[model samples]
Target: MVAITNTTSLTFLKDELDATLSQAESALEVFSEDTSRSGELKVCAEAFHQVRGICQILELPAAALMAEEMELVAEAIGRSVTPERMVGTLGNAIVLLGRYLEYVQLKNAAMPELLVGGINELRRSAGKPLIAESHFFRVDVTRERQPPAAPASTPRTDVTRLCRRMRHMYQVGLLGVLRGESRTSLKLVSRALARIDRLCGDAPMGRLWWVARAAVEALLADEMRLTPARKQLLSQFDRQIKRLVYEGERALESDAPLLLVKESVYLVSLATQDQGLIGEVKRAFSVRPRFTDGALQEELSLMSGAGGSVIRTVATALKEELNDIKSTLDMAAQGAADTDYGDLADTLVRLAGTLVMIGQSREAAQIRGRADQVRQWRNGEVDPEGMDFHALVDDLLMVENAVATLERRFAPADDINREVRNTRISLYQLDEARMTVVGECRAGISLTKRSLTSFIDSQGDRMHLSNVPSVLVGVSGGLMFLELDRARAILEGCRQYIEQSMLTGSGAPVREQMETLADAITSIDYYLESMEEHKPIGDAVLEVAEESLAELGYPVMRAPQPA
Candidate 1:
């Protein structure tokens, strides 16, 4: 494809494209004003269709996609009278496309990626799935990986049967992941991947499994969100597993899908962790994240909106001016002596200039028109008590509402559904103490797991279980202090089980019992991690811990709800 810059023909084409976009904008405005104007909608469709063709000729795929989506939305509007939001989206797309053409002309380059957001918005308004940000991102996935430790297996192991079982395990986890059970499903997926990695050994095919495991770990670590694109990538991993089961070990001989590898590597790069396989993969593949999703969205918001401080200052000044205007209008309507029409017109004229300075040219024009009306009323061209006076007041009220809308547009977003609970305690000190206790509890859980591992290895050694109860008790006390009564109860049950059965039993607990014990401990670990992150602790995890204990013949006590 030819470069977007330094092209005489492209410059001519862009000028023509600009004319078409303006036509689209005009048609869209007509349809928006009167949704019954299907012919205007058809005109918009034709304009965007032409715009799409021009983009394709210029080799601007992203831009073409945007135009194509806009055209489709225009057609949809013609089929039925769409909502105002959809019409507004179409209008914005028309304006944005025009601006993008100007940007390309000025910069002498076409950076199509910047148009992805607008394209997605058009698609969204048409009830279509959004394109991922990485739709334009390309990367080399042929780099050889430093394979993780090979999957443990014997010479007699049936690779096909093992692959089938592992694939089943992966599917179960994928279902959970799809249902939004992120933490638990991620753990299951990681486990399956670890097994698959062992089967693949150090061959080229093993690369996808290990890299995918790292990516899933990153997801588990809250390194990135489980976007639809990422979820689809994980689903592709299952397809690879299916290949191994049907195609036999030969599937492992070939490289994994290039897109899958790139996406997994991309995910690993986004993780903040600099240790273990995730960090190692980053080093080996030389993958460094450009930005996480949240960070990228934040940067986009900053680019699109005026600076916070600038907007706040403008808002304050606008409010003051509007207050004076309102006061004058109110007093004049009541026939007060302080009514001064000339002063009011002058203030409105200045306010119009300020609105234009803030990039509100349409609002500025409206205010300027109102100022002209004020002047006419002052010259006795219209009665102050007539319909004309009432229209002027109504228009001023609309401008006041616009000012309020501007304030809302720049206001910090809040999740009103998750109301922060009020407390009488000093929240700062309480939060600090909670953090300290949560940290210690996390440390204690880690220590207990290690001790439990040693006890299992030592085959009924009492010493390995000695420090377990004490550490758990300490963690339980911290949980109580933090008002996590359920977590405290679960920890207490584990403590009692270790004390009453494991340490005092004649021999090592059976393998099944030890596994169940591990399950209980692991569930508690997951809960604490969620708590530390301030995420909502689901009841399912606690039930899992309770079931594990019950299986071990130690029925857990239901604790009273925390105050």
Candidate 2:
């Protein structure tokens, strides 16, 4: 749910913000001429409402409040006494709207005192006054809880659909148990818990809250101490939750605690069973198959690295400066230098921080000192001292050139980075693969302890060995390309351990093998994290890993050993 919804919502949100800003600016322009475009003001109000709705759903209070304030100004255009007096105030509101959009995009923007004073003056003229000198950062948070009138955003899937949908999870659970598919059954229960967490998180319902709390704690539990067997049982917590679902049906029906948790996943088996549940409840439980063995993190790391992460850090800092410089450029082209310095102050702080991150503390300190020079200017637009644009403009140009140079320097190379990317993807695929292998290995080991070893396959303890794709060959090249030597070493050892201990026939007791695989994955994950964080990896660590593997009987290492 989170995966699909956030991706789509963010895109939709950016579009709405852009459209709303356009509408507000157009309305302001129309009103600036004669202050008599009541119809245009209404259109702007509708646009503001649209952006406000999407921001509310995203739980971004600051952006939503800015939209609300704009809506109020538009709503007052024709209705207020002396409506002609509010054009300048409305123009300030539109600019503030633009600043808020930038803030939402990268989270470093701040409201200028000019914008604040303008909004407060608008509030006074409209007879809808605000608190004097309200702090922009804290204002929206206090007011976000009060629900506004139904907003003008796109239509959404109703939260009221959860009751009938949750009823469907019960039958899915029963089917999973009947088929002896323990993992499937567990994920089924997990999907239910996700729903409850989304809908009834911290609700007053006693049983429902109890179920939510237990599932959350279990999901967040450390995987180091638990064997695969115990980890498999985490899904069973859903069985105890069945009763709570039934009792809480009334709460779901009444829409007492409304919410949208995540994206809906289709239930394939139920749809095929002629219960016609395929379309009905499939999306009700989108299971992401949480693997505690760090495969998920490895997959995520494919996109993460100092190359990409640091670039984002640099881009975000430079973006504000880019915006301000563009603003100054526009004003200078128009022969209007009397503008505001607040954005310049913010940009300097951001650049200093970015410089510090990139190991240029001296450059950062110089920029921080230069911020005092900038303060003598008006809103960072023009110098108040004899119009000294030459020195300030030169410094700005130097920073711009620095941004361009860093982008070219730190940008990832295609050949090696491709290997890093693919390796991460393959590792994610290996997460479920490893989970299946562990399940099969555990099933086989359980058989030696039982009399009916042959009957296990029919009982849903399926042996999943013959065609399981080996992670070693698939990702080894990529790992090597990334210079994740320690991870590559551990992965090679894991490949050998699987072949020797578990793959020839029906296999052996795999407690040691599963532990080994888990340990190898953990070590590799640490190495991957270190690389992403741009931290130095010690020379001794891979040596220690090799020694550990040799002790475990796998003749493997990422690099050659001494003769």
Candidate 3:
């Protein structure tokens, strides 16, 4: 037994209890006139009843006895609470109890001065009018005690130990709900059902066991409403739950308890209704799965159904761009500038938009920039000497074809194996095309550079010849130099075109092709350096071009040593 150290502590407790009681009593008076204020009266009455418990715990018999009567009055008023009488009785009870609670708290404080202002405020409220029936107030000198009675039902065999075993499963189900895990929640519900089955036994507290089983089954069915597969799983769980409940009753050898059966049936019906409501809500609001793991496939399927037309339109555009690029390239090769590549450009732009729609922004930006450049160059003014008209057309058409092939290869589809195989084939074909184009460009630049060097050399040699007239030599040499400069400028423009093509197609690994092009250009520069008398000017230009191309993954090749 615990010993009470300080009897003075009880005085403080009594004072606090009185203050709470007083507050309850004051509110009761205000509520008495209006029966519509019964809700307020009920709340005040509950406070008074709570104060009564605290008073009894502190061993203040007088305060505890008064509190017990107040509780009885409060309970009576709460049952048939009318505005006027409930307010007068219940409200008054709450005020008196509130004051009593406060006085007890004040006396318990280490310093009485700490509650000086508080005590005064409580006293002011306690002065308010309350309905006091004199006959109900009886103070008895004698106290009687009675022995505790045994409970009608015995406690079950350590079922709380079973709850401990299933604690993780319960948390998993709860957490799954918070995380929106439809399948995972169902799985947890299934585990909970098994745990409940293991714990069920012959006990007076069997109703709790039946209720828990029914609740878990209901939860399983509810969680499954998110997906068709889970719904089928729920049907299986439902049959099992019903069978389990039936067996438990049969083992009892009595008419199945109405409470267990009624609750089980009610929950099943509620689950069915809730499942229908979930389906309706999903359909009405167009709810889709957001997480990527198992939910991605479901969400993609839903998106395919809802936005099939938009996806088809993008596929059609890609196919058209492929055909247009092929046609344009053939026309360009024949030196025809009349063919409009605008359709290819337009398709590429739309493809970029489609990419963005499907969540591929990085790839989309590359396609968009290439298409925009092609469109702008086609429309804008061109430098007569600097432009390679045919090469420009070829580069644009190649970019269009490459982008279209990429789209066809990676567009989300049901048959991913076939698509992946086709993508690999397309990638191989694109690499071949890139190499062929780079070779043709290098050849064209080399031939033009050689011709320029030959012209310059021939004219310079003639001007130095003693047999030729000075005026004629000057005129021929000047005309030849001008032609040589024009040819060099044209080759330089071809180099720029190759560089830009490499930059645009940088997403593809074409470093080998780029290196080959750079090597060919370096060969042309070496030939020019050996043949031309203006070595300094040619060498400076060659160095800059070499550095730029090298940075673009075109390093200079080393000469082979003797074996």
Of the candidates shown, which would achieve the greatest lDDT relative to the real structure? 1
How do the predictions measure up, each by TM-score? 0.57, 0.25, 0.24
- lDDT for model 2, please: 0.46
Please write out the lDDT profile of model 2 over residues 1-563, one tens digit for every residue: 01223544555667767777787778767866756556787887888788788767866555566667768877877776776666667666666556545544442322222234445566765677453222321111111111112231211133334333433453444344343433333333444444444454333332232323333233223222222223333333333344344555444333212111110111121122222222222222332232322432232233222234757676666757656775764675466655556566667777788778876677677677777776676543554344456555545555555554455455422212222223113322333444443334333333322322332333423254332324445555556545555556666775665556556536453333343343344344433332332332333334434544664678563457569
Better of 2 and 3 by TM-score: 2
Residues 1-563 of candidate 1: C-alpha lDDT, one tens digit per residue: 11475467668887789888888888888877887777998898898889888888877787788888988888887665446878888888877777777766665756555677788888888888877655666567787776455544423136676577567657756766776656666775786787678767776788888789888988877546676678888888999999988887678678878778878887776677768888878887887555555554443454354345787788788878777887877777667765667788888899889888877888789879988878755543445689878776666665555555566466422111122234223333444577788789889999999998898888778898898998998998878777677778888889998998887876678765776677678767766665555443355556667777877788788855659
Q: How many backbone clashes does candidate 1 have?
A: 1
Span of ten consecutive residues with least summed lDDT in model 3: 140-149
Candidate 2 Cα RMSD (Å): 22.7
lDDT of candidate model 3 versus the reference:
0.42
Global lDDT scores for all candidate models: 0.73, 0.46, 0.42
Candidate 1 Cα errors over 4 Å, as ranges: 1-19, 81-85, 95-117, 129-133, 138-149, 152-212, 219-266, 269-275, 279-295, 306-436, 450-465, 496-519, 550-563
Ranking by lDDT: 1, 2, 3
Query: What C-alpha lDDT, on a 0 to 100 scale, does residue 257 get in candidate 3?
Result: 44
Candidate 3 lDDT over 243-293, as tens digits, reads: 334454343223334433333333333343334423332223233322221
